[model samples]
Target: MLVELVGQSGRDLDNVSANPARLVNVYAERTTEGERVLKSVLGMDRHTQLDGVFVRAMGRVDGVTYAVCGGHLWRINLHGSANDLGAVDTGRATLCGNNGYVCVQAGTRYFVYDPDADTITEPAAGAFSDIGSVEFFGNYTVITEAGGRRFQWSALADPTDLPGLNFSTADGKDDNLLRGLAMDGRLYLFKQESTELWYNTGEAGADAMARVAGGVWDIGLLSRDMLCQFEGGAFIVGSDNRAHLVSSGGFQPVSIPPVETAIKIDRPQACLTYSDEGHTFCAIIFKDSPAWVYDLSMNEWHERAEGVNLGPWNVAASCKIGKEWAVGRNNGEISILRRTNADGSTPLVREITSRTLRMDGQRTILREFEVFPRQGFSAGTMNLHISRDGGSTWTPPKPKPIGGQGEYGRRVLWRNLGQARAINAKLRWTEPRDICLSTQARIVT
Candidate 1:
């Protein structure tokens, strides 16, 4: 957490308070790209791998943290340091590059994260479903329309225009489908059809993009069913069903499992890269399930996802990066993964403590007050009854300023000042609870 001091009304502070949020040191395994995610979650038992995200970080995922269990934007860091216009939890995240961008979903809200100076400012929402997949295709940033029908982001003409898909309109269907988009520096949208559409991020709408040639299926083993990129090019994943390949050349059928044997993959992302030592693969998280990594090089399947003393299914999955990676379950633990030497040998997963909520609503003044009716006043209503000046004059209570904070102690918010009597008053209160008052404390002013 960064610390700073502001002049109170233009004058220097007599002595700036030293109490501030702490930034614990942490580590995360370096991806093939050599990016180190914050792995502050050390020794936090386990809460089960339940939910994750991959977005540029702007740090500050504070505010009403969106990380509540079953919470959507729990670990979404599609931002940087600037307190986004609303509530975006991103800090110290690495996106592709200046041209490359990241997308995220916090609850029903979806936006992008730019890593320049720590700022988030897009408030694009109002969709049927949460944003599913976001990719920077050749010339545009293409995003799946989320749960329901969605027009292309281009429709809004925001600089972050998302590419349009051929599969669905604003009416989404069978879209449990995922999108693999990247710019060869050119516009490209890859779905199953193999007919790769070349799109322009520069253009305003879907009609602007044009489908280029079909070299995408030309290279090695690849199919629309699964596509993953390695050092050279992308490879279509080995399927539990009939297999096929997509390369720089075109499409070619390969040998593998039959279509009927295909199982609903809990892993939503495309496994792009992996390491032999730890047998861990890079894959995007889907349905909050553990990330799947096949040790093809070592003939093993390893799970680098987060887990805890809680139920494995507590959250759907835990294979994710960023701040919210380890936040979930009864223990409320958080964890980040780190590489041992390099080859990913049993990637070290550690827990990080959450920043204590340093500041809170002002300590309830927990004050008690007592009062009594002047010499002759009775029980019912009394006109001008009591006064600070020895009861020389009676002053009625001002109903407007009542109920603010801890007014005369009855936990002010709970006290019915309007129904109070014009007599003396007495009130008492405690912490973590409300205030109480007796007949003696019931007063008008």
Candidate 2:
């Protein structure tokens, strides 16, 4: 009888003996035939490069895309061109758009960009010296006063108009407010140890918004940029060192043990959400670690790295321009996310490691192992590696041709006269051409 080696799952380093699957640069999805298969992640095609060190934020207003690169704000044209609008504070930025205006908050300065006038203007300084977060809700620009428990809003539809008295304190648990988000017509106030939900009441003054009686979530936000809206809710890195999906139902922990373990080791600096070919992904980026991507469609996790050094994926900000997903990278490059196999001209290294297979501690004779590569693939080689001692070490790679164009009948097979009680297998490939593994390797024991 033949036994399957790999299947649909993410990395589980916490318990490798039980589940040792590791997906890199690929995600698992169910096909129409009800079989799960791994698919390559869409690549980033360079759109434009700006004269700055890195892009800090991106947003769309009045059908135009805007980005903050280094100390300047720029307008990105649909034809992959950029125009420098003006200067702004240099640092991480928060952008929120409403009513043809985009509000920007960066490093103790608050500004608003009006596309119709083609200008960026700093709003009158409010009561706070620093702004923690910005969000649009109920025709108002909401912001949290950094290092404090007070939250404020601007005049209706006017991001430049701020009244000193137009603010309220979130005294829910006496914790300092860290960030805020507007989702489903509700304003979510996030703090260091808890979150409070408030909704618009259409009233005047202090009664303009009311808190949902029982809408307090015990989980707090990990950082200012670690929260983003997805589907109908929000994905947040909580202060408890785990990722959670916050919606009307409540907070649902989404980070598995291995993912959480990575989070605990390296703090996430930013989070971005985007959709590609019917799949939604939430990417968490760290300063010195590889990016961890969560596929909402598959409920699995994967790793995305950039450059020869295998560092973090360079995406720093993202926004939708028309129908395409435009991403701003840490190196001041704006790119369009495409369904290709290469990041611009760089081919991605796709890999998957299967779980450890143990035959109840009984050694068995291994016969042959074969894999079914998707038809119509061209120009690439798949390398297989095996480990007999539960991933403590791996054998030398054995390469097999995936066939050239029009050579779809090629078979990837390996015959061996070996015996082992437990084994782990890994497959890796790097080619610009489209490659897909229709089914994992089948081993006869």
lDDT of 2: 0.81
What TM-score would each prediction reach against the true structure?
0.37, 0.94
lDDT of each: 0.30, 0.81
Which tens-of-lDDT digit does each residue in 248-319 have in candidate 1?
434444322211122143434333342333333333323344433332333222233343311122221232
For candidate 2, write residues 86-157 as lDDT tens digits.
898897788888688888878757888887898888877665758877789999898888889888888888
Measured by TM-score, how close is model 2 to the native structure? Answer: 0.94
Cα TM-score of candidate 1:
0.37
The number of clashing residue pairs in each candidate reads 61, 0
Give me the runs in candidate 2 sitting further than 4 Å from their true place: 7-18
